[model samples]
Target: MDHKALSAHQAMLGTEVSRRRLLQLAALSVAGTALTGAPAHAAPPADKHTYRLTVLGTTDTHGNVFNWDYFKDAEYTDSANNDIGLAKISTLVAAMREERGAENCLLLDAGDTIQGTPLSYYYAKIDPITGGHVHPMAAAMNAIGYDAAAMGNHEFNYGLDVLDTFDRQLNFPLLCANAVDWHTDEPVYQPYSLHTVNPEGGRKITVGVLGLVTPGVAIWDKAVVDGKVRFPGIVEQAKVFVPQMRAAGADIVIVSCHSGPNTSSSYGDALPYPENASTLLAEEVPGIDAILVGHAHLEIPQRFVTNKQTGKQVLLSEPLRWGMRLTVMDLDLVKVRGRWQVAAMGAHLLNANTVPEDPAIAAILTGDHATVRRYVNSVIGTSAAAMSAATARYEDTAAMDFVNHVQSAEVARALAGTPEAALPILSISAPFNKDATVPAGAVTVRDVAGMYIFDNTLLGIVLTGEQVRAYLEFSARYFKQVTGAGPFAPADVTNAVTDTAPNGTPDYNYDTMAGYTERLTYDIDIAHPVGARIKNLRYGDDLIDPAQRFVIAINNYRQSGGGNFPGVTTAPVVYNAQREIRQLIIDWVSEQGQIDPSSFSTTDWKLTANDVPVVIQA
Candidate 1:
């Protein structure tokens, strides 16, 4: 490729460029323009010199085989509606295969495929894959004809047996070079796969795909994955595999890494574990053509990393989570001395909403979909009053109260006869679903599942009053500082930062405490920055004593250093109920046979701007 062609290719690699513009440039490169108005016929015989290889990938599908949110019991159609699922992805896969001939195309996944929705939960727990039924995730991806898949962190949520079931059922290899069997010091799964494809009249091209997963699995899913398998760093694993793949005669090398791009080592240490190492892998690993990234759940269409040693830019793309986007990478390769070399490459994302859901996919998974729908829609109990999370973020609402009450009660019960029984208990929870609600009638499992979507287990951590106040202060950062004393929209109180952390705080991290009785008046002083937002922190009638110790109810995620909340992960553990929090809520509500909201406080916190009352928008 000439300098002008290289420049145009670089322009296409620019992550900030819109997909439309990238596609336009891709069209120019597809022709023999090379950034110049050159005719295609002027180039050498197309078949003899060049081969166009299209790489299509999906990441974080999370078992959304149908374009429906099982929790909502509705078709996932839009941002407002619940319609994002792999059924929509199936359409894209078929179209991409047809657009770029299936012979020259590769379909891959970056992982987090097996665990997200009620459908996945139902299959993993209810009708387990181990019990004869094929795992829905593997079945769906196999139906779509995936080339290979990496193991995501969530893949280990159900333990090695469940992961093995899904892995065994898949038609393609579930690649994870980093996850190894400690006893033998070898990968439990295949380190990589070599895919040889033959386009019409084109030379055979061998594409090497190496997969790597985040090493943080040893921390997040330590209880399950620990001692069973060891997770090594992506860069460390890549160095070993790239040479092996090269020696194995791979023409083009691609990494299916189930991790985001993070420069920092995992937990701020250089112990071979990095939460995200796609960028580092690209920079450190040589002979890599492209990388498919996931785990962050952000829409990163394309990113280019300049290798520190060779200074060659490696292409990286991360399609947004939940089957929302499909990343496409078109590699312009040329035959050189009987071997194919990548000449120019461009990648872009296609949204699921761009095409209709594949009817064939819907037809294939109808039985599983119906099973989950029937299970989730069954009425488990009733509520005396409707509970809404619409105002839960700005004010204390019954949505959180219900979760906190169940959590606190479960913790107190779990601590019976334990030394921690003497400590006062408090429960901390966050509004996971802002639009969640339960009417004053029958409450189905879906209604409760919508309120608590995550499959987090309950844990009790011992924290001091000072630490509690600090936790609240961190939670209060969710609100943007109100400079003037005036009425503001409820939604406007949120900080202007996006959810992808290392930059912005996610709403899920903003936890609400149940045992403390204090008002979090919206009186955010603009003068005070982060870590100093909460005020009038008290428990009961008197101000909280900084030294007073309390046992707080928390989910396993918070206790496992998720969300980076202070004094929570490091706090002494009083009790660890290896029970899903959602199940606890279901059991508590089912036992009561009703959800009573009258006793739940709706105003544990208030918002005021510098002593002036602020009116909340409806």
Candidate 2:
């Protein structure tokens, strides 16, 4: 049943007398209509018997077919490389299938199959999947035998046409009840699929799987799917589809949701766009035997949510990201009369790092992997001095300076003829890769790509000095308040450690403002309730006035309100090149031939307190 129907059902159950009498009367009616005057509780034929079934899932693979880091041009081997690729996951899947019995297993994915790493970008933009080249991710997933997959937000990055190509090539169904045609409100892809499986000497079981993508896709992918496709809320769509699946004779219903379990809702009740509502989905929707959660990149191996209506615990699991973990949900069902019901359910996650890479699968994608490696390793330019973003999160580094400088220069060129050209231009960038580095001798496409991981485009916006201060205030939320501190550590300055996954904001949200001469002393106490962390803010030696207007360069993600940055998305957009920032950096270095270290280098922001020395993380 859908969320609303399920809610009414729970309310009916609360009135025990009414509910019990209603069931009793229905049973009497059924018995009265029996052909052979059989009892209401008569057992069904032996063919309709109890059986065990297993559900396995993976999410946010991000197109990693091999356990290799294309950006680093090395084998992905480290604790950080836990469950790095599909090859390793293939091995685990084999072992899991053997243990669970292949006949009883149904394999699935939670979306985000493509987009991430040099390999994915190479195929999407460089090779172009429509150019008669099969995407390695699609090929690898098909080989692994995925029964069904959900729609991830990133799947729309290269546009629907590209997604359609992958969809055409896949052997499994790509389900998304929420991604629908705006006018008709009908799903653009398969909303749900019913998989009929037969265990050894057991009755045929119909397992219904429904897929839902986060409604945040409407905002994140506005450029591509705006007028053609619309994304409705997860709970809203789940409320509609679950009941249909049950009516279609499904014994067990599973939701492969590309969302997290965050308590707060971004869209709220006003719009059908809750970014993370997996918890709400399980609690509100009835007949949901299991949920495979994704998109938050969390490592929740297993969780059981108690359905308020039935008081039955429903299994939920998320396998982190990048093929790191696999969630396996084992269920036992019993046939009562003619209907099958879930008797017992359990779930857990298997780490991909524990197994070796599947050689057969690796061999299939070797040629494509080598092609990407060669492209990334091609030398682009030379750096006069060594640069590193290893400490960029805690301090200003040459690595970030390189990005800001390139962005500012290009944005200035793009805005040369615009009315905002005369205004003071500033660039804002975040340290995407803390471990990225460029040696003094030479730089390759890999070095540039390592510094900027996302496929975000550059955008220029106009903002007043007051709005700028408000922007900085919102970013200051990254820091944790420290009172009466004699000596302060990075933990004292930021809550990076305590922030849990699916709810925690990453370090990338803490933006670093560049191009302007400013000092942020981190005077958090200046405003009693925190958030006022910047002090003595200056733009080229003069204190910034609240009335002054300036043009700022930022990525399209921030311009579209990816981090909820203040005054960014709402601010008047001055320039939109729609060009990828990473590609711009690659082109800039290729043209420059040599990058001088001093061209864009400085330490602009710092943490301070009343006679307290702040120690940042390394």
Candidate 3:
């Protein structure tokens, strides 16, 4: 789910159903077929016939094999002081399996196995797994014994060839039921995986795991997935597969979905399905005992929803992203006649901070980690003055201007001889990282990579001045309405929580525009409502004309509808070379050999409230 669209979905369950009430229904959900041939009023089963199964799950582990921050060149830390990495999770999994008995335990990951850290990026682009080099994520997961994983949207970032190579290297199956071939509508990867667990002195239990990914992938990765694959809604595909799993003799069915439990989408009405639909999947589809939710990056210990048709409760759990936590689900089964039926289910999260990194996982990934570290630390160029994005979200800073500069330069160079080159060029950028900085003396690959964290590619879209104003108005929703401006902290004015963003809008959703060869200026007036926030919109010295035409250098995520920004998705694409934006910035600096802020930095925008400049306290 996009950070800006994490709002609670009220329409799916109607006004009468409270989210708390729905989550309280987490007890037991047995398949009606599993209790066949048993009397309706039969006596309770004896203790001897009961069996227990434990499932350990993780999600959105975005390529952190160790608890290190490649950008900072140190151990990763946050305000919460949580530890991250698969190494720490591996220790927790080992301890759980040992205590619960290895045979009764299964380990699974919900998705996003690759593509966040420098290590994952190195394998995907620099060293490339397609060249016979094993992906470090695959090697680490295999060593830690992951039974299966679903496909995350980021898995398609480097294209299908790299994704397929990583899949082949993994010892376990990479499953995604909804991701189907565009031509044949057949599954592009395994739909589900069946595991037969044999308990001590008990009948064998068949566990069926169905995997589904967010349909927003169609919009987010349109460049790579356009004619190759299509994604159906989570509930749409679950309704079809749950019955098949039951008919195939699965005593228990679990869904590992790379979708959130919320029922909202960032892409507005562009797609027919909601981007986050795990809760809907449970309520609409029957026979699912539990679900492992992903993609929202939320820490949901446990949530329960009642199936509308069966009146059975389905348990759902999601560990926070980046290996910060683990979800443990325990299911108890009681035998009726000679078959096992789900008696009860429970789930909770375990903090990875409490455990130490497993030495074995470190041993397997140390070489790869070291190589990435060296590559990121190598000096690229020198900066004449330090530039920081610490205040970029609330104020215009040179760090973000540097990003816009590189992007606009690349897009302009690509359109040099084309007919579109005659038009004015503008660029859009977001404050992806508040801590990103470039030192005054020297800049390394890590410094540049930190400024532009996402692996988004670049594209040029033509937009009229009216559409550009609409786009800025949409981005202005990131701020709360302030009547009179006094000195306020940065957080006091930004990341407004509204009906659309229950958790508050993230910094990445707030974009600022810069001109390539001309000056584009505007003021975001917080005294006015959202749609009317952009004030004093001007291009150079004249007011922007509504019918004026210009080309904007934008990232693929935005052009493909990532933030649901206005007009960009349907805008005419004049240039798309599939070039990664971060790499472009790095190459720009390397080629220039120096970063001088005076050449590119300009303050073209500011915040105001009723004609008074909004003052932000340090």
Candidate 4:
């Protein structure tokens, strides 16, 4: 779920009456008043069921064998370290089963089960040499058990053939409803999976699990997918399929949606940025009793979501990303007037610290520890010193530096070190990967993966030194203004308390930037657009030199036009998505023989003074 979109959505739900206004603008679906990008559906009665369905799920496990291995307690103490593995998960599963009863509890996972962590890596590449490519995830999942799961964007990382291998290895079934092969209107996936469990005496209870992945995935990973797959409109698919599931034999339809909302919205429906949630889908498709959401990795404890459009409540559980938390949702199934329905539901996260890991499950974890260590320790390449990721201290982090290096190097490699490489490569990447910060140490596979965690494709944007300054100025507003005493940020940017000084968000701390770079947070002139957010900037080392022409290399989307960032549309793109950062790193290492840490880290940021920071107050 994209929490970033929730703030704006809350403001739109109330203005639903003029929904017909959208029909005049562009594409509109008004099965019910389509609130902007929101879907339509009727409200479910509050008192419809007597029994509660307790569904617990995990997503983006990324082969997290145990809890957060990154945290070594307060002092890097191994004894104090808490591991997140199936061992701990089993405990949560057992407790939920005991508390909610097996008949009503549904355990699930949301996907990205293939890559990210060393464990998955071990199975993908390493395990093939010793044991087998058969991923241990199936065995691990079979231990704790999962009711249903959906496909995530990362599931396609190794390509469809490998994904099919993973599916064959899984103990549970894969659920996907939206992906199609284009030529064959035949479903790209199973569409939905139905489960029958006893909630009452000889009662037939069916749960239809539906899956959907982001449509942008094709753009993000165009290299392997190769336009072979088509992602159908999620809302349209639900309208067509959920009814089919209901007609088939499903009494309770649960959407194991890979889409979800970030928070509460008064908006008729939530757009949730990039992806829409089950709330929007629920309104468009009926018979869905609950939604188990994944993608965008945000955990929501209040599993019950009230639809802003229909006024009906639907059970929603999202454990965010990774195996960081476990969500348990209890659904009560009961016979109401000859029809069986969800009577009750509740959701909770297993905080790893709260309970002892089940020993049997621990043994399975212990069993795999040696193999995992061997895979991680296999050494992609040995670095003499520490290679770090981008830090809050300097915005030009190791991650950004590496990303820029990859994009620029690709341009350099493609152009083969010609005068074209002299264009002064400027790369832009999001600074928001959960694992963007890498520690200074012996570089390992996990360290590399963590630093470049985002699916963001490395992009190169061409800007003369003059226009670059304006872009810098726009990004600088995120910095904090230092009063006589200290710096301050907006409350929205920080968790800290605000005073007359202001709050502290990461963007507010422009002072953390390096010295060579002038902090753009301050506006020197009150009325001028130049030197602000890429304001009418010229293309030259010397702004007067119109003769200077440079080619920019960005991702396929930004090159074709995205981000609404101007000049980018007119900007020339010299590269495709084929050159990936990870692959580039692998190639870089392959050439270096042994990676020297010094080769990777660089002092990319330098600060400039005499510049006035922004003058915004809390």
Candidate 5:
């Protein structure tokens, strides 16, 4: 390979030269005699020593095998009409392999493979792969022929036993460089994988793929992984392993990072390291040619960041979550001094909606899919009145209250006859899915499950009245400040994009509080600054006492510091039995045989602008 050509290419890209400017420069260099009437030299022929290697990546598949939604009992459809599932992605992978030559292509995933849909939940909680049942994700990925995958934070949701079972069923390795044994300080999973691609007539290319997951897992899944495994910083691990991969004769290095490119952590300072550190990893480390980013659930077709130490640009891409998109990275490698060196690289995303589901993948998981479908569709109870969470983020709704009612009741029952039993009990509920609804009559397990999408467990934490107010203020940051109460659309006021939430606060982060034996009420004064948003916070009929202690029914995710909410992580845990909150809701409905919203529903909270109730139009 010519060093001059590589240098010029990098310089052009560094200067942000446009395609037209590049074409003009090429014409001027190639047609030397056009202006001077001198003898013209022809352009050099294509390099035979150059090879194109295509790597396909997917992240946050989240147990989706088919394009069907078990909760809705129909095909999944979002506002964007984007198709999902590994079956759809399988077709795209097949075409790429065929087009690029199967020997020249590699497939990878950035994790969050299990525990999203009812399909994954059924397998993890009901049949359980630990009991010798094959994980649908493992079966589908094995059929599609994956080279490797990273371990996502959610992979630890079901504990190490389940993760190990899924890992054993995979045809490829599950890599995570930062997840190390607590006592041994040694990597628990494979750090990196090496693949040798032989170009038809050129030198074989040794592609080294390293996987790293967010250290936030240490805090998010502390209950399941504490003392057993610990997650170090992503960049910290990459710096140690990239050198080893180079020493092992790797010509090109690629990272499948389960962290996002953004340098932010939702868990605050709980951990010393940043949760999403892909950008930091590329900038601080050398020898990394590209990275497949994940966990942010955002689509980034292509992004290039310059390495501070090497001054070489590193390519990064993150396909949207749930197999909605697939990232394709193409690397142009040239044989330099008898070794293949990466000369150029770029990536783009392919929408799963562009292709149909691969029959082979669908056929492979049909039985598992059917079983989950039946499980979710089973009738659990009946709802006298229909309830929807469409306005839960901006206003109080019965749908969300139902979640709090069941959670608080369970926590209260557990704390019965205990020292804290006399304390006022409150429960926090977040609008997980805006589309979740409990239709009038015939409430199935799916209806209840759809409301609480996460597999979070129930937990009871003690928080002071002052801390509770602070928590509500932090959650109020989800709304944008406004003056007039003149009918505003929900989208116009909610999910305020700010420094913390560059893409806007997700629905799961905005929580509303509900009382168990008393009425806990507050007003989110969106007309004021964030810290002063929670006004008129009260317990029962009087203003809340600053020093008053209360037991709050919370989820394991929040109590574990998943959302960086104030005071929860340090709060005293009163109860934690590792009980799934979703199942509790199911059981609550089954035991009662009816969901009467009037029994638990109350207009306890509302959004207000300058003490004037805000009217949010749907």
Candidate 6:
């Protein structure tokens, strides 16, 4: 192929992807484009002069198969309603391979693939009939054809035993050099895997895939897996392993990580979205042609600026959580001086709607869905109406109130048989996506299946009344008070502070959201804690005092300083068991079976505009 032909093909690749994805693809050392299903054309044999490669990947798929949130069932049906699942994604992947021989394309995953939906939850929990069987996510992924994948911290939430079983059942390598087996003194994970490609002129290239999990898993999963498993730092591990993989006879290197770079709060207080160490590694480590990132669930369609270390550009991609979109990165790697370098990296969002579902994948997901319903549908409790757990108005609306109340009720009951049980209890909630509209009446299993959708478990923490106020004061981070009368200006959840260490990204400014983005702000007013914006102070039915010894109901993350919630993190954690809030909701619902919205009510948190500027509608 001549220069004109190559340039034409490269341009075609650009139009094939979104403008944002095109920018990420242009950063690649090589170039190529991809189509779905079967191909109308195929490249010539090994003797051809031109070479092409396609890289397909997805990140932050929080186990959403049916499109509807299992908890909400048919009730919740906004954009977050139904979306991507393995079947649709498999169809897309298969089509891409058909468009370009499967041999020329590499199928990979970033992380956070587990621990979001009821299926993942059911897997985390025991299979009621199977004695103790893990979920079928790994099996489905294998059936769908994932060549290699890195470890997302959510995978560790199930413990290494479950992970071991998952590793055994998988045909592809579950690579994660950073996660180690201290007991065996081994790396503990499959470090890397090789993918052979068939390009034009019948040329062949070996794509080296390396996997890395975020090191912060240590703190995030403290209750069940703190000391059992250890993780190597990402930047350090990449510095050592990337070169070794090349020596192992690989043509190109692709970094597969379950982590990504720092991002500001999309809608909550300083959520402190912990990364998997992919961004820092990209800038610090060389030889990595492209990167697949996850965790924090933000999509980077264009080239993200790496740190000052390695200045070379690296293509980065992370589609929105759930099977909402399949992030496709078409990497064109051609031989340069007898070696393969990144020719092009194109990223695009494959709408699940546009693609046909694969039968095998559909069967697996459908079976899992049935399994999920069998357990999830067992009515737990009655709600007065359909309630959601999504956070809203920078505060725990009805949903937060429900989960926190259930936890509080559970903790109170557990503590009822103990001494000093009169202490007031406080629970933690993120106020995330809480604005979900749940009409009054009967509540289904799907509505409560994954109330939080995260692996955060309930904890019983002891705290003083003074510390309690400090904790409440910490939530002031979400306040964006008004200078004058207008509307409630909420906090800037998307503020990527330039002060963050390493690379400071100022590219993302101006709130991209259109409306309902209140600019309400405020100061902590630390001198006063209780009786401030947050109320309903109590230990069971009794009121709370600044000196009372209270057993607070909280999540493991807040118990470990996650929200920087004053005394909550520093408080003594009395109990830490289970894997997800859904399990608790499941138990709560199962004990009741049929739920009405009345069973779930709003907590003490609500919006107030006293002693501040006018509510401005900017």
- TM-score for predicted model 3 compared with the true structure: 0.92
Model 5, 1-618: lDDT tens digits are 111222112112222434334333322322212101111222212466887777899999999989988889999999988889998877777666655677878999998999899999988999898998889888888878789999899999999999999988887999999999999989999999999987766666799999999998888888999999999899999999999999998999999999988888887788899988999999999999999999999888778899999898898989989998888777777787788777767777777775667776776577888788888989989999999998888889999999999999999999999999999899999999888999999999999999999999999999999999999999998998898885998888999876556678888989899999899999888889889988889999999999999999999888998878999988999999989999999999999999999999999989888999998778
Q: Which pairs in model 5 have colliding backbones? A: none
lDDT of 1: 0.76
lDDT of 6 by residue, 135-250 (tens): 45665676666788777877777666766676766667888887776575457778888777756554577889998877667666766566666666777778888899889878
| Tens-digit lDDT track of model 3 for 350-407 | 7777666777777667788889999999999999999999999989999989999999
Q: At residue 503, what lDDT does model 5 achieve?
A: 78
Of 1 and 3, the candidate ranking higher by lDDT:
3
Whole-model Cα lDDT of every candidate shown, in order: 0.76, 0.76, 0.85, 0.52, 0.85, 0.58
lDDT of each residue in 1-618, candidate 4, tens digit only: 121222222112132323233222111110112211122111222343444555678777776655534311111113433335554566666655654566667777777777765566556554531244456566567666676778876777666776777777666788777778868856777888888766443456677777776554554455556568766666677778888998888887777777555422111111222454466676656567777777656657544556555556676767756554676555555677877765555555555434455555445456565567554444465555544433433234445555445556566567555555655444554444433433443455555555444333445445545444533554444433332221323332222222211222232213111111111121222122323422323322223233444444455433332322335544445555455455566556556645443544454442222343332333
Q: RMSD of candidate 6 to the true fold?
A: 9.2
State residue 283's C-alpha deviation in candidate 6, in Å: 1.2
Candidate 3 lDDT at 243 equals 93
TM-score of each: 0.88, 0.88, 0.92, 0.71, 0.92, 0.77
Model 2 over residues 413-485: C-alpha lDDT tens digits?
A: 8877878778777788887887688889899999889999998888889888888878877666666666544
Candidate 1 per-residue lDDT, tens place, 180-286, comes to: 89787799999999999876576678999998988878767766876778887889989999999999999999999998875543233424466878999999989
**In model 1, which regions exceed 4 Å deviation?**
1-45, 80-83, 182-185, 199-203, 262-272, 495-503, 516-527, 611-618
Q: Which TM-score value belongs to model 5?
A: 0.92
- Per-model C-alpha RMSD: 7.7, 11.8, 9.1, 12.7, 9.0, 9.2
Where model 5 places Cα greater than 4 Å from the true spot, the runs are: 1-48
| Higher-scoring candidate on TM-score, 2 or 4 | 2
Superposed Cα deviation of residue 58, candidate 4 (Å): 2.1
